[model samples]
Target: MTDWQVHALKYADRNSRTRAESFIFDDNHDAPHAMDYFIWVLRRGAEVILVDCGYDSEEATRRGRPILRDPRDALAGIGLKAEDITQLIVTHLHYDHAGGLHLFPNATIHLQEAEMAYATGPCMCHDTLKMPFTADHVCEAVKRVFQGRCVFHDGDAEVSEGVTVHCLGGHSRGLQAVRVRTEAGWLCLASDATHFYENVFENKPFPIVVDLQNMLDGFARLHELASDRSLIIPGHDPLVTTLFPQDGPEFCWRLDRGPSGDFNL
Candidate 1:
């Protein structure tokens, strides 16, 4: 069985459109750009797991996000479709991370139960909490539960042979990151738990975080779990392609191999 295969299913990128200071550190005047969201396909034998669904282009435009490419197009390049997806791990219920849920019909979704509550609960009124999510998407996930496709977990849990999910409540309640053992080595998808590598390296929590303490704690936990810090990939870091190898043409991306020992700067 091949270990793990990941693709950059980017739905959007910050291409000189909007300046977001919220994603950067307090001391730095630099603009830290980001990729919206996409699926991480982990395959060992016939089992396949998808981490996060990229949002639709229309909504992204409505929100004034710069659309780089369509996520579905990225999936097609890998010969996959929504129904072909076996399982999905939602890092959080923010629209960018979970909006395309309508695309995957046959996959059982793994999500933090606390995340579901927070997205739908009254806590969204707080400025720090409400800005990152879309209530409509949370409502859809709730509906999927009745359809027997949602698997809710409170904390850490194993979804398959090599994938582990750690529920970290900070960027959003129930937001989790995935750690997978691959032939290359251990890879941890920081998801939205930490938007950029600088957020972890500098201990700076992204501005939209709900619980500041949880966000900081989550960063520490990521460090503890990484086989090597380099394998820990941030959710929105623009430098991911440069840090790792390129698989195709100038724009395409690829995953790299390493141990759980050191962080890749």
Candidate 2:
């Protein structure tokens, strides 16, 4: 079995977020909470798979979240160009996740079946439900589908030998999580499944949930997927950068090596 090397690359973040927006019905909802945006890279030899594409500059401008570094440049730092990516695992269709679909023209996209339906289906008609998604990004996926570059998974399926995706819909109707075989063991990239360590450890749901129960269940699943909590990577936690061995505070953090030290809630 090939041990996949995984790296979490942070491109942007929002320091103005509040706990109220992160957890539901929490007493400290008014306290400050921050979020770091990232796209994970998985590679071992010639196989290179991208987890999610961070949002583009336009989305950053509209959402009031500025990009600290272009995700493309971040990938460049790791010696990968856009064309070098051949497989893309889209956990969901949220703007921040799928917004950069155009950035990688050569990669075949892997996604959950229900996610496409939820994005293009009746559920997207609701403003609140559609807020996290951008029409352009969804359409980009649609375009890839038309070009025969998209692969849909009904539930749990393996995209490659040591890489698999599991549908853990909570934040979105068809949201999924990625599991990879790394040096430490089976590592779970708990994308929106658990936005932060607190979301799972504290059992608090992120405010933007389609199925609250699914989100909660996914947390338990995350634990089951990884050998230890340190092997599980949250989708947007700033603590990630500090907890792992990385070159800097706002760049790539190696996930396959496990955490450098202990972390508490």
Candidate 3:
């Protein structure tokens, strides 16, 4: 099988009071939680593919989330220059995930066809549905489509030899997860499909969901696609950084290698 090195580059984090019920549907437990924001890089020899373009400082301030560092700068810490990135997978067009697309001047963005429609169509007319997205970010993606830099996928598609994007729209109309063949095994990057390991392992749906049934089904899909439960990486969990081996003092974690710790779940 073709193999690639995967790295999770964390750019910012926030501490907030979250009701457990909000994360796990129908269960109530108010408490504090830490949410981390990250962008992933998959490298196979000379080829590089980025998962998401994290939000900038302005976005952080606008959203009331703290900015640790610019995502482009964070990518640099992992030896990747934003301008050189030619391929990117946008999981969704939410402000936090798609806000920094302009940084990659020469990149072909891969997105789910449903996602583009959801972001630009009538669904966004609802305040609840539109709250998670930034119009400017969605517009940027539209511009990319016009520029011939956007590749829309209807469902599961191979991005390269060992990397595939699975369209599992639950969190958003076109949210997708990346499955990568790595030295450790197939690592499924569950970007927002599950924000934390508990969300999947416990079958708990995150509160902000477009389709509850699909969100529940997505958990099962993630398990089916990953090599094992341990190889599945949740999108915003701080435990990911703790479980995987860090690349150095930097915020990047090496995902191609087996995790440093045993899977707690």
Candidate 4:
């Protein structure tokens, strides 16, 4: 059995009004609203895995991102430094999820090859698609690839025992999610495969989705993969803290319980 723990590394928070302008639907004029950027960590045994790397404080400031603190600082609250991480998984290449990668220099990162190609490919000609990414961030990711720290999977691949990555392209071409065996059963991490729980619950696709049909299909797959709805977690929902119990000394909010009664704290 594999044990896991989850930690929230909040890098930024945006007011609802700011994010609503571009994201929320309104019969009236486009009103702006804000959202938050969070990175998560999964720990199993002596191995520490990070789900995403939020933007660095400086990068966020330069980009005019309304942030609360550096993601590294949040990690520090848990007594972990960047180097402490052994593995990193980027569900996709969106800026909010892939920003603070530079902070972890010693990790071997897992990613979908299609995602890397898409982010650096011709599809970027579309402004809507390009808006979610920062060129510098992608470039930095490329550097990591050359440095031999990047691991690209073709489609579905298991990086560890009972931890599997599945292809569920929708919001992005190579968007993927994670499924791990736990004491409670199977837990699926629907990372950006369906941003908020509302998207899946209401069957409303995020307007920014690359393919509407795939988004719907992904939701179905997620439900099938998760033994129970309560075991499924959305990428950016604020409700995770309420649904799971905190288990570590710092920043340890676990997502699932292992066969040995260990949890993803």
For each candidate in turn, give its C-alpha RMSD to the true structure in angstroms: 2.9, 1.2, 1.3, 4.2
TM-score, per-candidate, Cα-based: 0.89, 0.97, 0.97, 0.86
| Model 2 bad stretches (over 4 Å) | 248-250, 263-265
Clashes of each: 9, 0, 0, 19
In model 2, which residue pairs have backbone atoms overlapping below 3 Å? none
Model 3 scores a C-alpha lDDT of: 0.90
Which is the winner by lDDT between candidate 3 and candidate 4? 3
For residue 76, what is the lDDT in candidate 4?
Answer: 81
- Model 3 Cα lDDT, one tens digit per residue, 9-121: 99988777575634855445667778899999999888999999999988888988877989889988977899989999999999889999988889899999999999999
**lDDT tens string, model 4, 1-265?**
6656555555666665433333335343355434445677776777777788877767777777756767777788777898898788888888888887778888788999988999999999999988888888888789989999899998899988877898888889888898877666888888887666766765756677787788889989898878877777777765565556665534446666522233232
lDDT tens readout by residue for model 1, 33-131: 444444566656566678898777776766887556666666666666767886899999988888778777787899999998898788987766777
Write down the lDDT of every candidate, Cα atoms only: 0.75, 0.91, 0.90, 0.75
Candidate 3 segments exceeding 4 Å error = 26-28
Predicted candidate 2: what Cα RMSD to the true structure? Answer: 1.2
What's the lDDT of the predicted structure labeled candidate 4?
0.75
Which candidate comes out best when scored by lDDT? Answer: 2
